[model samples]
Target: MKRRDFFKKGTTAALAAGVVPIIASSCATSKAIIDDRKKDKWYHLGTGKKAIPERKITKDFEVAVIGGGAAGICAAVASARNGSKTVLVQDRPVLGGNASSEMRVHLNGVNSIKGKAERETGIIEELLLHNRFENEQESYPVFDHVMYDFVIREPNLTLMMNTQAVEAIMDGNKIKSAKCWQATTETLFTIRASIFIDCSGDGLLGASAGAEYRTGREGKAEFNETYAPDEPDGWQMGATLLMSSKDMGRPMQYSPPSYAIKYTHEDAHPRRSFKWFQDGIWWIEVGSKGDIIADAEVNRHKLMGYLHGVWDYIKNSGNFPEAENLALDWVGSLPSRRESRRFIGDYIVSEKDMTEHKHFNDAVAYGGWSLDEHNPGGIENISEPPSYFHYHFKKIYEFPFRSLYSKNVSNLMFAGRNVSQTHIALSSSRIMATCALMGQAVGTAATICNKKGVLPRDVAKNYILELQEQLIRDDAFIPNRPANDANDLTKSASLIFCSTTTSGDAKNLLNGISRDIDGNINHWQSDGLNAEVQLEWETAVEISTVELKCDTNVKRNIMMRKDSKNDELYGNHVPIEMLKSLSVHGRVNGKWQDLGTIEANRTRLIKFNFKPSKVTAVKLKLKDTYGAKNIKLFEVRCYA
Candidate 1:
C-alpha cells in the first residue's frame, strides 16, 4: 500500500479503536498484524520482531519551510497567502515550537517596549487576535490549536507534523529537495521545492545543504561588536527546562526521585526568584563548552536534573514556609533552546547596527528588545548574575533583507535565531516577535522569487522595493518607509465624506503612512461613530479588489496570557480601535449597490475580493467600531 493510504488507514483505525499507534522508530510502518486473538491475547505472527518497511513518498511545492516555530509558522502562512504552494515540516507533534504546550514559553514581541506604536501587525498580529477571540481560557495547549487552525486554514499550504527533515538534496549550489522522515507513519518524504527557508533554531536544513554558518560567539574584531569576547569560542547560550506550580488550596508533600540533585541556598543566587512558581523558569539551563546541537539529549537530561533539584529545594528546604500548599503542575520534557547555528548571509547584523541605528535601504523588519544574554555557566554559575543587559534601544531599529537570505547557498533563506547576525545582534533579534517578522519577510521574498523566476539574492537586489510595498500592503510596518500610493486607484479620486474629521483631514487616508513613525500623524480620525468615506472617479473604472487598513491599537497589548497582571503584555483582551462592523458599496449605474460587508472584523488589514465591475464610485460605511467611540483608519485602497 502507498504511504499516504497507510496514514489514512492508521488515522481511521485510531478513530475507531480510540488509541493511536505510538511511533517507536523511523523504520516502523503503520501496518498492524496480529494472531491468536481468540485466546483473549494478541500476538505477532512473524517468527521474530522485524523492522517496519520503509515507505518513500515524493512531493513538490514552490516553497518548503522547515521548523514550525514562530518563524516557520509565519513563513509558511505568508508563502501560501502570497500564491506559493508551500509545505511546512515540524518535528514535534504540535506546532509553535517553544511557545507550544510542550515547552510553554510565553510569546514575546514589541510588548517589551514601554510607550510607543511599535507593535507588529501582519500575520503574527492576526494570529494573536484570533487566539484572544477563540481561546478565551488562555490555555497553552489551546494556543497550539490556534496555530494549527491558522496554518490549516490556508488552502495552498500543506502541514506535516511529527516529521523531521533529516537531509537536504543539493543540485549544484541550490537546494533541490529536502528529505524528511515521518516515523508516525513510516514514511520518508522527499520534498522538491524552488525555495527553502530554515526557521529551525538549529538551522539543520541549511547546515545539511552546505550553507556557511557560525555556531559560537564571534570575536569583537570580526564584526566590530563591543559585546563579543576577546577571543572566539564555541560557547552558545544554554537550553532551559521550564516548570509550573499552582496553589492546591491544601497541604501537599513532594517526593524526589533517586536521580534528583540536591540544592541549597548557596547553590542559587539571591537574584533568582523561585517564589512565583510560574511557567517560564529560564534559569534551569545547561549546555556550553559542548556542541549544543549534537549534545541536545545530554543537555536535556542535565536540565531536568537541575530542575528537580530546585523543586526539592523549594519543598524540602526549611527556608520556604510559603511552599507548603503549592504543588508542581507541569514540567516540560523538551528543553527550550536559546541559541545554536546562525546561517551566513550577505549582510551580517552587528551590535553597531542596533546601537547606532544604521540605516538600510533594503530594510524589511524592525526590533527593539534589549540585549539579553544569559551566562555561559547557566545554573552552574551561581556566584554571578543569571543574565546581563548590555544595551536597550531608545526606539525600534530596522532589520534589512540582506541578512535574511543566504550568502553562499542559492535559493536558501532563514529566520529566527538562526538568521545571519553577530551574537550581540542575535541577543536582541532572537525574541519571538522579531523572528516572526523575519519569517514573514523571507516568505514574501520566496513568493516573489517563484513568480519572477529568480533566486533569493536576486529578490534582495532587483525586487526589493516590490517586496517592501507588498509587506506594507499586508499590514507590516517598516520603520521609516511609508506605504507607497503611486498605483492605488483611490489616490487619483476625490474624497467625499459624510462626516468631517474632528482631528485629522480625510486626505490622510491616502497619505501612505499607516502607523505613527518618528512622531508623525498619518491616520484620519473622525468625530461621529457611523461616519462614511467615498471615492469617485471621473469615468467608470473596473474594480476587483478593495483593501482597508484600520486601527488595531498597536500601543496596547492583546496577547493571551496565563497570569492576570496589571501590565499590558498579560492582558487578554481585544483591541477596541478595530472596526467590528462595516459595509462596502459600489456605484455601477449611478445607484449605489452593496459590494460586501464585514460583520466581526478583528484584523488590522481587511481585504475584499469581488467580481470585476465597471463601478463609478466606491463608498465605505462604518457601522461601528469593536468598542471604540469613533471611527479611525490609516488608508483605503482600490485595485483594478
Candidate 2:
C-alpha cells in the first residue's frame, strides 16, 4: 500500500480502537513506543509486537492566523500584543508572502499619492522600521530573516513555518479548529482557536469552513463600481515572476533555458516597456480565467519560462548594450499572486466608496494607493497596457470594519487580497502594507471576540467605537478619525505648552490625530532640538506610561524597494526626522524626578514605562533627532 493510504488506514484503525498514537521517532522500536504509550498506543497487526508512531500534533490558541504574509504577520502580532495567544501559520519556509526573499516584489503601500507617501503605520510600520535598522545592507534574504525575527520574538505568539492551514473543523457556523499540514515535519497540526483569521492570499482555510466567498470579477451593476467590468467575468489579475541581475566585473555570456518561451516584443504595448532593466520586469506575469489557486503550479512553471525569456531578450537582443556585464543574480520560482477567492463580508467596498471617499462609521483602517488594474492576459496580451491606473486619490480613504470578517463564517475573518472588496477597490487596497493595516484591524477584533465571547458581526454592531479607539491608541491612522480615549489623562491636564514652537501648536498633539494629512496640521514641531513640552494637572495624578507619536516622515516611504529608489516619495534609509533621544521628568513632592530616558528610538511611536507615581506636572525633554534640525511630534498620551 502507498504511504498515504497506509497513514489513512492507520488513522482510522487508531480512532476506532480509541488508542493514542505515540509521537516518537518513526524509526523507534515497538517496545520503546509501547513503553511510552502505556498500552494505549496504536498497533499494526502484521508487525511482530508492533506499534507505529503517528506523525501528528495538536495545539491550541486564542487566535490562529493562516498566512504569514504582511497581512497575517500584522494580524498575529496585533493579536499577540493585545493579550491573545496567537499562532501564525505559513505554507512557505519564510514569513513574507509576496515580499519574501523567494519573490523579490517591493513591499509597497501608498508608495506615492499626490507626490507623498501616506505610508501605513502601527505594526506594519514597526516591521518596516525593524527592517531598516537590521537590514542596512538591504539584502532580500536578510529581510526574510528580519521578518522571521519580528514574529518569532513576540511573546504569546508562535510562528509555524512550512505549515499550511488546509482545512477548517467547524462547529455549526464557527470554526472550532484548523486542520493544518506541516510538510517539513511530516506531521499534521490541529490548531483550536476561539477565532480564525485567514490572511492566506488564496483563503483556503476560510473556504473550507463554508465561507461565502466569490471568485472572478464583479460586474459594474453589482457594487455600482465604475471601474468594474461591464459584465462579470472569471478573469483575475495575474501573478508575476520577478528576477534580478547583477553586473559582473567581466562580460557574462547569456543563453536562454530550454523551456523559455520565445518573446518577440515588436508589437508590445508602449507602457509595458521596461523602465529599469537590471531589476525584474513587473510585466512578466500570467493569470488564469478560473481557479487561479488550483492553477498555481502550472502558472509558476510558465512564469519561470517567461522570466528567463524576457532576460534572454534583454541580454542577447543587441537592442541595449548596458546589459553586457549583467548576469542573473536571483530568479523567483514562486509567482506572487494578485487575486483569488474574495470572502464576502457585511460591506463590500466598491469603487465609489473609495473614489468619492465614502465614510464608514465602523472604519478601522485606511488605504490610498491608486486604482491600478492590470490587464487580464498579462504578458500574452502584448497589445494592451500593463495596467490601467483608473483613478487617483488626493486624500486617504477609510476601510470599514464590516468588510473584514466573513459574512457567514461567524468566527472567521480575513485580510489581504482575500478580504471582501470589489475587484475595483482591491486594485488599490491589495498593496501589501495596505493589507497589513487590515490585518491589524481584524487581529485586534479577534481579541475583542475572544474577550466578549461574541462573533465578529456582534462586535461591528455594538463595540465598533471601542475597536476604533483601540486601533488609534495602537497608532493606526484611520482617516478623519480622532481618538477619544477616556482613560487618557492628557486630556484632563490643565495646561499643555511647548518651550518653543515653529510650525504647529503644542495643543495639536492632544487633538488625537497621529499624522499630518488631508491638509491638516496635527503635529507639534519644536523650533530646536533641546525643547520641552510640559503637561500640568490641577492636582497630583497617578501616571506610569508616556506614549508619544514622533515623526518618522510618513510622507516618504520607508519600506524596502527592489530598485532601491530614494526619491522624494520613496526613501531607502531611516527617516532623519525621527527623534533619537528623549527624557521624561515628573514633579513628585515638588521635586523633578527622573522617570526614564530613551537614548536611541527606532519607532514612530515611542513609549516610556516606569513605576507609577503621583505627580503634579510632567515634563518631556526632547533631545537630538536622527538627522533633522527640529523635532516633530504627532501625539502624546499619559496613562496609569
Candidate 3:
C-alpha cells in the first residue's frame, strides 16, 4: 500500500482504539464551558482529533540543525564534536534525505565527479566508513539505522526524529528559537540555539525566519552565465518520485488506478531509458509551473500519477518481454525535491565562479560536478533531454565561506543546496557529498562563533584561517592550502629514528600534509614495520596534546557496498594500510613511562590529549598495520 493510504487507514483504527479522545454521552459539556476551556488550552473537539497525547518541550543548545539529510547529519556531528551542544531535527522517521530508504538515491559527492583524490573527508567519510563496518546488506533501511547510529554515538548531539520544524521564533534579525511539532507523539519542541543551520534543501527554516532568498532561474545577463535564459523566468527544476523494480521470477499483473496517467510509446520518445529497472527512476518528475513549497502536495500527487503511469507503460505496453516477471519492489511516497529557495549570503556564487575556476580568499569547500540542469517542463517535454549538461570541471573549484551565511539574518547560516549561490552554480554544487563538505565547514564555523562569542559573518571575516585550520585538524582537506601546525614541537625539537627504509625520510613527518597530495610528498615509509621515531627536547617542555596522521590509501575506494568493482567509488572493506597497533612513551622523572597504547585503530587521523606534563622527550613505537608490510605515516604533532 502507498504511505498515504496506510496513514489514512491507520488513523481510523487508532481513533477506534481510543488513541484520540471522543466526546462521551455521559459527560456532555455545555457550549459556554467548552468555549471557556478552549480559550486556555489548545485542543481538538468534535471537528478534529489527535492520536498521541500533546506535550511541549523547550531546550537550548549551542547549535540547532533543522534537517537530517547528509548535510544536516554532518553539520550536527561537526558542531557537536567541536565542543558545542547540538540538536538535529528531522521531519521524517529517517535521515539521509534523498539517499534514505524512502528515495533510494545514491550518495554522490566529490568522488562521484572528481575521482578518489578529491573525495570528501571528515564527518561524511567517517559515517561512510562506519556504514562499511556495521552494515553488510547494503539495504536502504539498514543505511537509515546506520545514520541513526552515527548520530546517537555523539554524546553532545541530541537527535529529534519524526519532528517537523514548522515555525521560527525571531528576535530582531536573529532566530530566537525553532518551533517544531511531532505528529506521532503530538509533542511540540521549542529549541533555542546560539546558531542555526538550515540544511533543509527547501530552506524552510530560513524562510520562516524572514531570510532574504531567491527561487527559480536567473537571467543570463545577471551573472553572465551562458546556460541561463536571456530573460529571467520563474521556472525551477522539478521534484521526482523515485521507484525500484525487482524480478519475482513469475509474471505479476498490474492494474492502473483511476488517477494514473495514460501513456504510450510516442509519449516517452527518445529521452526515456527504460531498459533497466532495479533502482531509482530520475525522470518521473513534476512541479515547475506551481509554487513548489506551497503546492508541494499538489506536485507530489502529479508525480505519483506520472510514476504509476510510467510503470503501467513498462508492464502493459509490450515494450520488453524481459519485464514479464518484473515487479515494482518499492516506490517513494515523498517527492525528493531538487530546487527551492536559496538564501542570500554575503557573497553569491555564480556560474563563472565554477566554470572558470575563480579563486576566493575564503574558499572552505570544493565541488566538481558538471552543471546538470534538469528541464523545467519535466515529463511534459518529450523532445528535450531530461537534463542539460553545460560543462564539466578540469579540477574541483572552491566554495567560499562568504556564500554560506545570511546577508541580513545575523545568526543564520545554511549549507546544502540552499547556500548562497545562483541557480547556475547551484546546479553543480547541489550534490549530496559536496553539500556534506559545506555542512562540515559551516558547522565548524558555528561552533567557533559560539565559543568566541561572535557571529558567522564575523568568523568568516576575521577567524577564517582558524576555522580552516580546525577543519584540517579534523581531517577535512582544502585544495591549495597546506597544513601548518605552529604548535607542533617537532618543528622546533630534534628528530631521531631507530631505523629507516630505502625511500623514506623521518623528517617528512613534519611536512604537514596528512593524506596523499597529488601523490607527492608529506609521508614517510619504513620497511618491515616495528619502527621507532623519537622527539627530544633540550629543556623540559609542557605538553598536553599529541596528534598522528597515518596513511589510509586515499587513492583507493573504502566506501561500503556489495559491489567490489575496483572502478566504483564504493568498495567492500577498509583500507589495508591503516595503522592497527601502536604505543607511545614519554620521559617522566628521567625514566620513560607508557603514555598510551592503541590497538586496531581504523581512522586515518587520531589524537590523544592528557594532563599537562613536563616531558624531556617522547617516543612512538609502531608494531603492525592492518595489511601493509611497511609502516607509513604522514604527519605527527605535539602541542603544549
Query: How does candidate 2 fare on TM-score?
Result: 0.92
CA lDDT for candidate 2: 0.85
lDDT of residue 226 for candidate 3: 91
Error of 1 at 432 (Å): 0.7
Reference-based lDDT, each prediction: 0.81, 0.85, 0.78
For model 2 the local lDDT of residue 141 reads 94
Clash pairs of candidate 2? none
- Kindly report the root-mean-square deviation of model 1 from the true structure over all alpha carbons: 8.7
Task: List the candidate 2 regions with Cα displacement exceeding 4 Å.
Answer: 1-51
Worst 10 residues of 1 by lDDT: 6-15
When sorted by TM-score, best at the front, the candidate numbers are 2, 1, 3
Q: Tens-digit lDDT track for model 3 on 448-500?
A: 99999999999988999999888888888887777776766777776556466
Steric clashes per prediction: 0, 0, 0
Candidate 1 matches the true fold with a TM-score of 0.90
lDDT of 1 by residue, 103-125 (tens): 88777776667676467889999
Each candidate: RMSD to true structure?
Answer: 8.7, 8.3, 7.6
Best candidate (score: lDDT): 2
